[model samples]
Target: MSISIIRLGIDFGLVVLIWMIQLIVYPSFLHYTTTNLAGWHRKYTPLIGYIVGPLMLGQLGIAIYQVSTDFTFYHSLSILIIAAIWIITFLQFVPIHNNISKGRVSESMLMSLVRKNWSRTILWTLIFLSSAVQFF
Candidate 1:
């Protein structure tokens, strides 16, 4: 019921989701042929967006609320990190995914996805850990 608890839950969800994406989902793109990967990416992006969109919005919204209400160090840090994630997602990842959807699949691009995702994996994990610390 507490805001901290809700924030922790959202952060935990992101941590798990990003790990799955980094370790399993993105890497699996390498196994697909170009045409198949493009076709699958078209479907996959929208479906995955359903799951990712809400969680990310929830996380960002809660972070903003927390900082605006309390203005503590932890809340500020969380909001900053969330902002970074959003920026990276839109500025970097979105274009790549858009290209992939348009049949621009390449081994280098797939590998870059896996490589670039480590930044998010670490950031989400850090957010979760910080949330856990605040919760406990």
Candidate 2:
């Protein structure tokens, strides 16, 4: 019923959307292109990647800001979790993708990045859910 509660709900929804994109939509999109469109790798999909990747990062910002701006008496846990996730995203995920964008990396590198970064994803998912509890 309050602003913080609304923000938390929106944040949770966006976080779930992100997980769906990463785990479902992206892989399916790539897989479909690999089969349905020959030469997708040469230009088309990479261009889409350039756009979609940044969009995902933007969504992350949305979630982070939503969580950060919501103030509650016990907000420290939410703040700490969002801050940690943001740091991990900057420190761990960004560099690997930077390499990819520069042609200095490979899919294997990104997969490696994801594997290493899985904990952050799970942690943030938990953070989103836990933050939602403040509404109750």
Candidate achieving the largest TM-score: 1
Clash pairs for candidate 2: none
Every candidate's CA RMSD:
0.6, 5.6
Per-model lDDT: 0.93, 0.57
Best by lDDT: 1
Count of steric clashes across candidates, in order: 0, 0
lDDT of 1 by residue, 9-120 (tens): 9889999999999999999999999999999999999999999999999999999999999999998998999999999999999999999999987899889999999989
Model 2 Cα displacement at 47 (Å)? 11
Query: lDDT of candidate 1 vs native?
Result: 0.93
The lDDT, on a scale of 0 to 1, for candidate 2 is 0.57
Write the residue-wise lDDT of candidate 2 on 42-123 in tens digits: 3544675575455445545655565567645445555566667668767986676555444554446545754665666587
Q: What is the overall TM-score of model 2 with all chains considered together?
A: 0.59
Residue 63 CA displacement from its true place in model 1, Å: 0.6
RMSD score of candidate 1 (Å)? 0.6
